[model samples]
Target: MAETLLQDPRTKYPVPPFPKQHQDVPGRQSAMQPVPDCGEDSYVGSGKLTGRRAVITGGDSGIGRAVAIAYAREGADVLISYLDEHDDAESTAQIVRDAGRRCVLVSGDIQEQVHCQAIVQRAVDELGGVDILVNNAAFQMSHKDLQDFSAQELERTFRTNVFATFFLTQAAAPHMAPGSSVINTASINADKPNATLVAYAATKGALQNLTGGLAQLLAEKGIRVNCVAPGPVWTPLIPSTMDAEKASKFGEQVPFKRPAQPAELAAAYVMLASEGASYMSGATVAVTGGVPLI
Candidate 1:
């Protein structure tokens, strides 16, 4: 018998400081030096979410894209919400359609409450109804010094990262029946704040709190609200926001010495959305690769 060689995810090597690269805020996947792995080739769905509908914000690329692909493969219709990343969004849509599922692309700034509400409405109208809601979209900027952070940036960060979560959930809640799940993308920053990501960190803290409170509020209604707190994940946000030097060392601080590939997160999102997590709510699943959320 021949032995099969399998990649050991635990020993995946760290990415060295990448070649200096930058994109205007909201980066494109095509421009990335090493394209992110969104489980396009690797993940094989087991029909965990068959006959379901999911609405994922930031589904254009990175973890959002990974989750969208996973959900589609699991037999769910997906509505992907993105901010002006038309090409990336189309690419993701194609992947979902390729998976034998329906994919709807809604492009707009999630910062607006109206836009967030519209995301849920479109899902109901198009995908039928929302059974899974993943608030996976976020915005961040690196500012080492407090003074360097602008007021405009502060407001934008909160609006996009925090407010949108509330808006979308409020819009989606009434339609969600018992056994539906809501998964928000929190960050390790909620536990260990990075000095440069103050605003983004603050918003993550807020999200975790919202996740907990809503879990309690929705318990009787049978909706589960949870979150994933990831540490340094290699995504377009790194190169687009950090200077080359910083981006290269992005995942070094973790004991694993490398950021998680986007594909690595797909299982956690799927598990939370599936029926297996029916009894789980208000939990923060830390997928931080070796980083402690303590």
Candidate 2:
């Protein structure tokens, strides 16, 4: 048998000449041109999370789908919450099922407190108890000037990206026992604000703060809370939310000169949720393709 070449984790894909593309809000994975890699064929699990139950918001596609796949392979049953993306959600569920785990799909706008509570309840009822909660769903739009930012946009962004995190975490934490984990998805924008993405960046900053505070607050309960701050990642959100020019140059500022693939982020999340990271909390792990969060 021919030996399969393993890519050096630091240097795999070269800088891509991203083509101009666009999709409506909450874009579909199928519509993406390069079909953002979600580790469907690459990731191999070693039973790190065996028999655990997890709730992942935005689990329909992109980073959320990648995390669901990784967790399932690591021996977890997943309850996915997405916002009316039936086709995308179904595909993710199929991947989880294929990995020999229970996969539950819930569709709703998580901005509402009722829906957030329902999502957690569903996880308890369907998967038994929540061991890991990934608050990954988000909303973003780009504008050239601060003047273009609207009051309506600010409210909508905060409700989806910030409020939902609080609601879901509150709902899921009670059912979570000692050694349970919560992983929030922050962004590079939290550290280095993008003028055009001010609203989105602000939400990410809020998420980071929440992750830190919750880690301290939940310490007595033996629950760990952390955040993943990714730099430019080539996900459905890129083409859908960014302009053609911005999309093409997305990750160029990073030393790697390219955006990260969704698969590239799975390891950090897996570590945060596993027993290996029991002592890790209130930390922001940056997977920014060499862009320093510090």
Candidate 3:
């Protein structure tokens, strides 16, 4: 189904113009004009996750791709899941391997429980047990009115953004041991909802609470669970979900007034999954561009 992504260019609204150019969500790092700063050239590893294996959902590009690169840099092999951005996913895998780590790519929809289990199993079989799990795959659509939202679309949104986390976490739990880490991707919308993306905002809110609940549930098992709530960062999902105008103007609302690169958030994932965050759990690390939630 992911292969079908970006097929229907006939969206609810018109794609607007950006200051320069823009790529859609599930964007391609290669195609970006200046290119997205993914820190591949200088992310030297210190063996933080030496001998570890990880599975990063949505690892083809954006924040997910950055995390995959970071994990590889930290001495861990990686398994990247995606709907289809085949070339982008392969490019990421190549980078991981070039970093002297292994990488696996699995393409499919996470909506089905079977697909989730298969992904986990394949990771286990191919890369060994998963020591780090990053639930970063997500999608959002802008709708002027809730009545305009389709039932199918809403279900798909929740299935991919929310249920995928549940299904993957469930599958990964068996293989994870003490000191294993699970990081979920929350968003700025959780605390400050964007009226145009109510469905996405709601799922993110649920995701934040879910992260908290999972933290408590997994603590007894010695697995650390946490979340990263990133404010307006530029990703392909932007252009793909929103119109062209919104894509280029992204992050203009945040305090920083500029979109963050996925690489900017990589350190957080590395810290949470590595030795740096041994005692940290259940906390949602805010990486938003100065959007404070009290």
The best candidate by TM-score is: 1
How close is every model to the real structure, measured as TM-score? 0.97, 0.96, 0.91
The best-first sequence of candidates by lDDT reads: 2, 1, 3
For model 1, the stretches where C-alpha displacement exceeds 4 angstroms are 1-6, 10-14
In angstroms, the error of model 2 at 287 is: 0.2
- Poorest 10 consecutive residues by lDDT, candidate 3: 8-17
Which regions of candidate 3 are displaced past 4 Å? Answer: 1-27
Q: Look at candidate 2 and give me any clashing residue pairs.
A: none
Write candidate 2's Cα lDDT for 24-113 as tens digits: 888898887678888999999999999999999999999999999999999999999999889999999999999999999999998899
Candidate 1 lDDT, 1-294, residue by residue in tens: 889798665565446566667788788887887778888998999999999999999999999999999999999999999999999999999999999999999999999999999999999999899999999999999988999899999999999999999999999999999999999999999999999999999999999999999999989899999999998888888888888788767887777767888999999999999989889999999999777777
Better of 2 and 3 by lDDT: 2
> What lDDT is obtained when candidate 3 is compared to the true structure?
0.85
